[model samples]
Target: MTTTAVEHGPTMNTTATAVPRSSVGLVPATATLARQKISAAIRSGDVIFAVFGPVVFFLCFYTPLHRQFELGGGDYAQFLTPIILLQAGLFTAITATETAGQDARAGVHERMMSLPIPRVAPFLGRMAWVVVRMVLTLGGGLAIGCALGFRFQGTIVETFSFVLLVVVFGSALSMVTDAIGTVARNSVSIASVLMIPQLILVMESTGLVAAQAFPDWVQPFVRNQPMSVYADTLRALASGSAVEPLAVLLWSVALLAIGVTAIVVAGRAQVKR
Candidate 1:
């Protein structure tokens, strides 16, 4: 009778298996991706272009124009430094459009979606790499500027502030281009679509020539456009004067919002496909 104990099935282990924590945060992961992107750019010779492009432009324009024209009563090269820096950022931003377009055309985004990583990681990674290139371009431009008699008339803080403004604006513009690239048919198409607007902005802005220099018909547009505002603010940062920083800030925010919306739309479209 006592031996009638029910046979026990396999006893379950009540110990909870601990889930291992991931050591990487978004910053580190994004940084790793940034490094990878930068390495790829270096391998592709993008670094060379980023470094030398501003130098060449500086040589071509600054050398010939410096003695002929004095802007704001200072050397033209000094006056042109801000614009040169801005141009470097612009050129670096172009890579974003090309790379994003290529990724979209190649179905790279689709493959990335299958991975365990965050969806935004790739985009942020590309942006981080863009910043790296921006820095390089800035450095190269500054070096060339220095070589060509461009000096910072402002204090060190002012110079740094000028750099910050340029980089931030460039980054905003890059995000806009990134979104455009995601939807564009190809890199060439992205370039074609962006070229006219960018050219207009650069050529008509107060960075290269005074707003007063523009024809009467175009002066109104040149004086009030976002690019003109940015160039004016940057010029002020260089030598100190009245500038419309608020306008540039608002414009940057608007561009960033548009870019984010475009990326979301493009991502949804990709998912549908």
Candidate 2:
């Protein structure tokens, strides 16, 4: 009787809503972002730069240097082709600065942080363009080099090695430059600053001239520097001659380590805002 007289209380709903898993995976997000970057590069004439940058550089170097190299009993086209391929990678790195700077200025990274997709997707997307640009530039550079009498005297494996070396160096350089672009306040200024070192390294390297070609005082720096080592290694690969593979491997590893370090440091240094 007392229970019946008690006032009835309202029922509380105990049903819980299941949280949904994310529909977008990291791979798809990275691919989508990469496509976006590639498209932007196309719209901005970056594609043209990728294909023609090496062509212009090749002509500039070869036109003046060919007779000189030939006079010295060497084919400049063969001697110089490897460096042009490597420079294509350098060009790619420089271009990455502008695009990465644009993204930083646009608040794209901040927007990305709010999404469920992996944060690294956007960076990986930008790197995909680096590979594409390097490839395009390599192809164009090779075509021009071949037209000018550059030939691969190496076996298929060595030729492949030659190519792999160029791409790897370019990729490492791109990674460093891209990270710089992302973190630097003024990417265009960064590019200009890099150009000086680029010119110095290429000009002083055995790629453009023999170690003996430089003055005795600078020869020590010119002969053993990283660019010179890379140039010498690439020449060996193209000529099907033996080189210290361990040295090239060490250089590659060092370059890659520097690149990865740059990316990680830049990511940590980046402001999510």
Candidate 3:
């Protein structure tokens, strides 16, 4: 063929090359990714960080700190035992934000967007890790609590239900953090934004200090905050008393709603970028 003809033929062949078929967004075989993520979380100190607060809570009660107050039942360890679980939920959510930010910065999130895996898969995968991490931490907390003479006052089923409540809520909280991370652009912002409110409202004792003694102005809002509900539920669990089913349901739904809204907003921002 002449030079012009040769060039034209190759151009035609280039256009004729088929685009590879994309994978259907069917559920991915995510077992391997799940394992890898879980291993990484453990190796990266995520789980260890989750463990620290619980251990510290245990020790605080096991020491002179318990003498400062009645500690309800005079067994500060038991009182703090269930609270360790609340702390676990709080810690995982806070940590997930920074981790998610790192993943985004590393281009993992951007890369995933190019794939055919369902958009929800990444969130679900992270959520699965949240559960695994929370459960492992909860188990550790419980073990330490038991070792320190904190016994579950409820039936096995009741105890499991309480744990389930904590895990479900914790996962929802983690999703919120993930969405926040998507928009944070860096780790420091993530920490500053997510950690502060959590510490002040949840971990700190503005309302928890004196549930019945808060200032009238703060009482209304503090009573409705998730941490307050968490503390109450924990007290119930520790004492083997009935937990408020409605409170748990309401708080869980509220958190899930916030997370869902955040995810949708973050997804839009990500796509725009």
Clashes of each: 0, 0, 0
- Candidate 2: lDDT of 234? 86
Clashing pairs in 3: none
Best by TM-score: 2
* Candidate 1, 1-273: lDDT as tens digits: 567768879999999999865445577768877888889898999999888888887787777667657644667876777777777777766778998888888887887777656778778989998887888888888898888777766777778888888788778778878877887777767677676777777788877777777899999998888777777777777776555668877987887788778778867777787
Model 3, 19: alpha-carbon shift in Å? Answer: 7.7
lDDT of every model, 2 decimals: 0.79, 0.87, 0.73
The number of the candidate with the highest lDDT is 2
- Which should have the higher lDDT, number 2 or number 3? 2
**TM-score of candidate 2 to 2 decimals:** 0.90
Task: Looking at model 3, report the run of 10 residues with the lowest lDDT sum.
Answer: 203-212
Off-target runs (Cα >4 Å) in candidate 2 are: 1-23, 271-273
TM-score of every candidate relative to the true structure: 0.85, 0.90, 0.82
| TM-score head-to-head 1 vs 3, winner | 1
Candidate 2 lDDT (Cα, whole model)?
0.87
Off by over 4 Å in 1: 1-25, 71-73
lDDT of 3: 0.73
